[model samples]
Target chain A: MKAIKVQALSKKYGEKEAIKGIDFMVEDGEIFGFLGPNGAGKTSTINMLIGLLKSTSGTIEILGRNLETQKEAIQAEIGVVPDESNLYPEMSGIDNLTFCGSLYGMRKHDREKRALELLKIFQLEDVKHKAFKAYSRGMKRKLTIAAAMMHQPKILFLDEPTSGIDVASARQIRKMIEDLHQKGTTIFLTTHYLEEAERLCQRIAFIVDGKIVKTGSVETLKASLHDQSGLLLKLDQNMANLKQSLQEELKLTKVEEINERSLKIVWPPDQELTPLFTFFRQKEVHILEAKRMEPTMEEVFVAITGIEHSEEKGGES
Target chain B: MNKGIALLSILNKDIRNYYLKPPNISWGMIFPLAWTLMFVLRSETEVDLIEILPGVMALSILFGTTSMLAVTITFEKKQKSFERLMLAPVSLYSLMLAKTGGAIIFGILNAMVPLLLGIALTGLRAINWPVLMGAIILIAVTSTFLGLMIAVAAKEVFEAQTFSNFFRFPMIFLCGLFIPIQELPALIQPISYVLPLTYGVDLLKVAVGAEGILSVFLNFTLLLVFSFGLFRYSIHRMERNWMN
Candidate 1:
């Protein structure tokens, strides 16, 4: 059974349509990424799937149960790590974990034991007795994720798991997420970090302005943008009068003048580069650097959605 | 998962997190004693402690319940921790009951200071023990639910406090806590009957061998109606907010 299946899902806050009839599914045991920029409706869509918000239209089936009818049942089997920590700040980390387990109906002894194990696993055992409010931002987030794992949920929904944190903490969380996926758990992660999506997700959906613009694996997303294939040339001297000559002789599809000494030639992937080299050599505008520009997920994301990923511009907090 | 455990889990967490904090404990302990002293010092005549006991107890429950609701409901809503509780396996009704359970218990405990003081001054022989216990429990439940009603629409802890004071200060004057309901103007008597604290304090007065306008049956019945009505209405409103 699919871990989640949402069809024609929409959420409206009065006249403002937040999620405009989006459709997607996450298969069991697969890590699915919902990639988008801020205010792209990623959080809204996840909230609806987790039953925290009711959809204005359409249906959500989580673990083969209708969310509208079996919200508590579905929720019992799924765990959500919201964009914020959402755990009690005044409570100790171990206390928070055991309390979360109790909400899932675990016995006191069992919950205590599980909480200890999780504390050790999450590398929080040393400070398990400290209040959650006393922890650093990274530690607080780790505890929140650990609390959500108290019941060993089959499917985990994480929204912006590594959006704003120290680099080491982000890396640690990514490793932990990879570990969870390896242990046969299905993960549905929403993030604006395109590199994270490319690294962690087997399938990804690009959301923009409350709509699903594209959905595919990392390779497919990049390959589909192959029409943007081009050769980049860096020159030793300013293009001077050579820009017109190269454009006219090469009959290039498009030439992007990157700087005084460089240009991007949108040549077909199948086209030969020896001719361009000969043209450049004849003109003695020595080719300092010449190569195809491989598109990163960041590039594919910007190409498809027309919105830059925040992390790409170092705008992350 | 067994839902009873889930309900108790939320209750247990809330008690540990907010209700049992040191400042609230100190407030609960000092509120009744301070009120008792004020009442004793105010009256030039030899004041029978039993005559004013109902008012002090009712006010204690009111303050205790409303203050805790500010922490349990309004604060959790602000922090989004309540959303985590909504993800639990328990039903919405059970979840709300668990969330307010701490405040109800606190309200009852708050009344104990005055009850002990009353016993020391006037002795337990004059008090109707069974009816008084019922009255205390009913008052706690009804006031806790009333606090829930105020907290549902509030976005901040201070907002809950302001809303509670708006209801609480008026009920102090109108609920026959100090003055008889008949002494109030005819226009205000109808308003007195509508306040939940009116029935609660009247029941307390009846249990304490003081002159009370309402019968025990009517007091208990109205308190029950207000308790469930306020609880159901608050839960309905909160459920909408939680889901959205």
Candidate 2:
């Protein structure tokens, strides 16, 4: 059996659905990315997988064990790093990790050794004796992941692991994630940063409004955009407005913000770019450069989630 | 790998992080001391130290454990630290035990403050040591579990304390803390019997050689029952809260 097998899982909060009957699987020893915009049920799905939230309907199987019935058994072999740092703030970094190790039933000697090892592995050894609350934001995030890794679980679930941290720390964490993946831990990663998923995930699932609209290898998603191609629109100044305008005005499936001053617009090979150029000129936006490019994962995400149909389109100003 | 270690781990962490914090330590010490001073000052003549000893000790355990446990649990939840514990491999019962263990210890310690004070004031008398120990443990257990239930009932710390006071203040009046249950207005006497703390103080009364209104065996049995009932209910509410 796969490491994670979520089948038709759903979660309801009163009258609203947070996770709508979504299904996916994480192959053993591969990084599986669950990608979505905010409020797309990513956290809900992770909560269910980790046994914090029960599914209203459907099944979740972790390593062939039913999540509902075998939660403790499954929990014994799985570790999770939530978006926020949940370790005890007043405790030192080492204490927090050892405490986590103990929760997984690690012996005191072994818990201590593993906590020390993890503190070093996550580059938290320098602050190992420092109170968690005293550590910098990046250091705190690292300690949290170290705590999760203390038990040496077979699978690791990281939810927005790099969100709200400094760039250098995010880079370090991403590298650590790759190292963990290389060491044969099946990783279930949820992230909004498509670039990170493109770089790390072996297979990705795109969830929108609680439903998964796409699930396949990065290559499979790219393959679907065969007839389509991306047009990179590099501007003189940052214009988040340009991406929104393009998506709304053209009703295009893929117009993404590549960075502050650039957008990638995807369309069929036969579609004319002249109209977009005309629209840019009319909006008094200077195009620094425009180049043809292969369709990126952003295109696949937009194509899959069908963001073009998203309502309340910003009045095309 | 035993669950025993995990229980100890959580208890130790809670003691270090919440109960042993200087603010909490000060608060725990002040409650019993302040109560001792208040009643002492209120006496027009000589203070009857023995008469108020059991009441002060019971009140200390009740307020200290309930306030401290409710605040710690709610704070952990708000900070998402409790959510981390909930994800641990331990069974729910073990987890709950670990969570309340710190408060139980604190409750017993709070009772000790008044006991020592009483001893220092009146000179240690013919106190039944074993019965006093048992009563202290029972009261601590019952109060901690009651606090757990109140914490489970509310979302935020303030709400937990408000809900906690709803039960705690009534117990002070009805649980024979300041007044004998029989001397209270007849209409409120039944409320006294229903309170877990009342049974606890009754046991304390007998332990201290003061005549107890209820049978000693019945008081012990009722306190146990109340502790178990509150514990089970807290777990139920916890699971319910955890899901959504």
Clashing pairs in 2: none
lDDT of 1 at A228: 73
| Model 1 steric clash pairs | none
The per-model DockQ list reads 0.76, 0.60
* Each prediction's TM-score versus the true structure: 0.94, 0.87
Fnat of candidate 2, please? 0.75
Estimate the overall C-alpha local distance difference test score of candidate 1.
0.86
Which candidate tops DockQ? 1
lDDT of 2 by residue, A1-317 (tens): 69999899999998999889988888999999987766778888888899998789999999999988989999989999998889888788888888899888889899999988888777878888988999999898888888888888899999888877899999999999999999999999987667888999999988889999888898888888876787788998878756677788887877778899988877666788788878888888889998888777776777777664233122110
lDDT of each: 0.86, 0.86
Write the residue-wise lDDT of candidate 2 on B1-244 in tens digits. Answer: 4778778889888998889999989988999999887776665543366667788888889988999899899999989999889988888899999999999999999988878877777665867788788889999999999999988887899999899889988888888877888899999888888899888888888877888887888888888899899999889888888776
Candidate 1 has an fnat equal to: 0.74
- Residue B49: error of model 2 in Å? 2.1
